[model samples]
Structure formats: C-alpha cells, structure tokens
Target: MNHPMVVGIDGSAHSSAAADWAAREAALRGVPLHLVHASPPLPGNAVPPPAADRLRHLGEQMLARTVADLGDRHPHLEMRGEQSDDSPATALLAAARTAGLLVVGTRGTGGFDALAVGSVALRMAMAAPCPVVLVPRQPAGAFGDGVPAARDVTQVVVGFDAHHPVSETADFAFSAAEARGAGLRVVMAWALPAESVSPRTPAVTEEDRATWEDQEVAQLSDALRAWREKYPRVTIRPDVVLLHPAEALLNASRGAQLLVVGRRTDPQAVDGRLGFVAHGVLHHARCPVAVVPHVD
Candidate 1:
C-alpha cells in the first residue's frame, strides 16, 4: 500500500528546509504529509523537573507551526503533526514502516557546520524500512525559499549496477521522474577488465576497449529492459561512465531533482551500512539524495 511521506522536524534550519522539501514532494505524490518531532525525555536529574514538558511543548509548537505553514502553501496536500518520545532515529524508523518515503535534513539541531550531515540522517538512510531522502540545508533554487517552477528541475538521476540492478530502486526512480514529468538518467560506471588491469599486461587496444564498451552498454540495456517496458512514457537516458560510481553520480547530479541510490539490506552486515558508493553520493551529491534499500 502507498503511504504518506514523513518528515522529521527539530526546529533547526536544516529540518525546516526538510519540511518544505517534504511538502513539495508530498504535493507531487498527491499523498498526505506527516510532520513528526522527537523530543526524547531527558534522563532523570539532568534538568529542572519541568524541562521535559517544555521540550515536548516546544516540539509540539514547531510541528504546529510547520503544519500551518505547509498547509497554507499546499492547499491540496493533507498534513498532520505528531511528537514521539523515542530517539530521532528510532522515531523515524518506526514511522518508516508505514511511510512511502521518509524525508530528513542533511543535519539537525546538532550540526554546526553547513556541510555536516548528522548521525540521525546517516542512521535513517541506512536502516529505514522505506526510501529516505536527505534534503540538504542549502537546496537548489527550485527547493529554496521560493517555490520555483517544477518544470525547471527536469531529471532524476539513478545509479544502476548492470550485473545486479535493484528493481525497486529502478522503479522508484521512474516513479519520481514520472510524478514531475522529468526524465530518468540511469548511470552505470565500469572499469577496465581484470586482464587489462593486471601488472605487466600490455596496454589495451582500441578494439578491446570498443568491445568492453559494447558489453557494458548491452548490460545496461538488459538490466533496464523491464523498467523501460513498464514506464514507456518516462524518458530514459542511459549513461555508461568510466569514472568511479560515486563520482559519476555526483557529476550527473548537478542539475537533477534527486539522486537515487540503493542500500543493500543484508542482515549480517555490522557497519558501513550504506556502502561506499551510496555513502559517498549522500555526502557529496548536490541535489536531494534518495537512499532506497534493497535485498541485494
């Protein structure tokens, strides 16, 4: 079942931007927007007895204010607010089970520098049950203070691994593009064959390079064949790049509405949850980044 888009707000500039970003996305998806704020009760003896009430009260006010602001801006979009006592990550993760997409700030009240993507964002990106979008503190012109023309943001860039492409991720990208009448650019990064990269190997010939490129192109085509059939109306641009996957995606994301990447849902993994490529893009991508987890 489709679920409402959820955003976590903490009365910070980044989270405020996240709320606005979520409002726009909810409007695009034609779904409800749920505003959630987590103000975990302080440990005993840490503050005045009334501090918990004050914190919760503050969170409620923030939620109310956000709801009112977004309600005025997006008349057709449904909006509601709630406060959770769980940690930010815990609160959002539980909400994720019922959310189609979880939106969060690149940082929260804790991040001092503009470039710092906080721990909660990292945790949710790795463990959320649904797709998660990390809206940066400083967003693009379209996602900035003024609501620019949506048509100006024309593309959703998705990184695809031809050998083991994730269908859910591909579909997510297609759906996002379709929602905005934007194009989908599927990017694949490859390198030289093992034989060519080995020590003492002769320099690759033009014929071998041509063969490799053709093979990579074919792989990309085959990987996306079903998606193309499913989303015939969505314009698809398949990009096979020679750069590292993260760098290639970062470069492609310059003018995109969103960069979509996949996280492996491996139960046994202890750390490095988002993986190298995804983690890199999340840290560096210029546009909003979506981390869609898949059972790879």
Candidate 2:
C-alpha cells in the first residue's frame, strides 16, 4: 500500500489552497490524502471551559468542511480528517512520521500580514521526517479558482549541488517528475572564487571563465548520470548558472510546477533553521517548493 500524503489545515485560505494542491498530488500518486487540524490546549484559567469546547468544535467543523469539499472535487480519492490537541508543529510532525510527503501553506493564521512564511511552516519544512511541500497562496486576480494556470510545458525544477549531491533529493525530484509526466530541470549554480578578484591576483580572461563553466557543467552531468539511468523516461535539462543558488532557483521556477531543494538535518543539533538557499526560495519561489531533508 502507498503511504498517504498529509496536509495541515487551519481554516485559512492559504491552508485551503494547500489542501487543493495536496489532493491533486495525492491523486497523481494513487495515494490517500489526510487532513490534520491542530488545536493547542488552552492554558490554565486562560479561558472558560465553554469557550474551549467551542474552539475544539470549530476545529472539527473546519476539517469536515475541507474534507467534504476536496472529496467532491476528487471523487475517487480517499481522504480522512482528524483533529489533534497538540500544537500545530507537533501534530503535523507526528502525522508526517508515516507519510510519504507532508504539505502545508506557506503562511497560516498566526503570521503577520507582511510575513511571507509562518513560523510553524518554516519549522516543519526544516524538521519533518518526510519531504515537505510548501504551497504558496494563489496570487490575487491570478487564479480565481485557487488553481494555478495550466501550462503547455510542465516542468519540475531542482537545485543540484554538485559538490555534495544527495541521492535522496535526486530520487524525490525524479519521482515527482515521473509522476507528473513533466520534464526535470536540474540547476547547478557556481561562482568564481573571491580571491580571483583580488588586486594581487592575475586577471581572469574570458577563456578562463568558459573553462570554469564547462567544468561545472561536467560535474552536474556526472552527478545526474545515475539518476538519468534510474529514471530513463524522465526528460531532463541540465542548467549551469553563474549566479547565486537562490537566484538561479527562483529564476528557474518561473514556469515550473514545483521547485525542489535539499536541507541538511543533524540529529544532535538543537536548532532546526533552514539553509540559506532553501530559506530564500521558500520565500520567493513562484511555484510550490519541496524541501527534502537529508543527512550529509
């Protein structure tokens, strides 16, 4: 049996959009969809028992409504809704333990209007046991139905670090592309050494830059060779950019259906902050971003 895809819900428009995206993906993978709503326990003497009960009821109502709506759209997709008494991050993480992929809104009801991503969403992306997909809200007046515009050319873009390639990350990207029947764009960014610009350093000519670019392209190809063999049907485009990783990824995400990046996880580390590249694209990527956790 295929592991179900889990999505967090909070009665917000953003969460609704996430649920929609998750439903489509779940259907594509021939897996069930699970919707989870977390209602934190009220503090002692913080609110009357009646109000607390009302809050819990509201949470259940939200989940039921979302599940019903999604079921109507995806008639054949199996789905289940649950309400938990733990914090948002805790409940979602627990659900993700047995899930193949976890999905969440980029921002929820807790964040400020100006914040691009919510604290809980960021935390989940960095620490979830399974790969997490952060779905951004549809832009105003862009997709009135909460669905993105269908593109003639579908593509999945992944940021590849040739220096430290992770097979798990590659696997996720290739699988996603294969499932969607979309082309995979493997992007690798490189920059000239800072010392090369020093006054005492010899001037680097155009030929030197060309050679460096060629080397980076070779590295990217070598890293993806095995993946290409494993997923023979996935059409791939290798892109080598002379820019920052975040910028390269954001640019490549213009018409992409999904953007994938890797995050290094340390079991012993207390902090779960995301890496610079993952953080940047999570905030500005035009399409859904998937953060795949791996141990380097």
Top-lDDT candidate index: 2
For model 1, how does the per-residue alpha-carbon lDDT over 216-271 read when each residue is reduced to its tens digit?
99999988889988988999999998889999998787768888999889767633
Q: Write the per-residue lDDT of candidate 2 for residues 1-296, one digit (tens) a residue.
A: 28999999998888988999999999999999999999987989898999999999999988999999999999999999989999999999999999999999998988798888999899999889889999888731234346654542378889998888998888999999999899999999999977767777668888889998999998888888899999999999999999999999988877578889999988887546689999999988757899998887
Error of 2 at 232 (Å): 1.0
lDDT of each: 0.86, 0.88
Off by over 4 Å in 1: 141-152, 198-200, 267-272
Error of 2 at 227 (Å): 0.8
How many clashes in each structure? 0, 0
Predict model 1's lDDT versus the native: 0.86
What's the lDDT for residue 150 in model 1? 42
Best by TM-score: 2
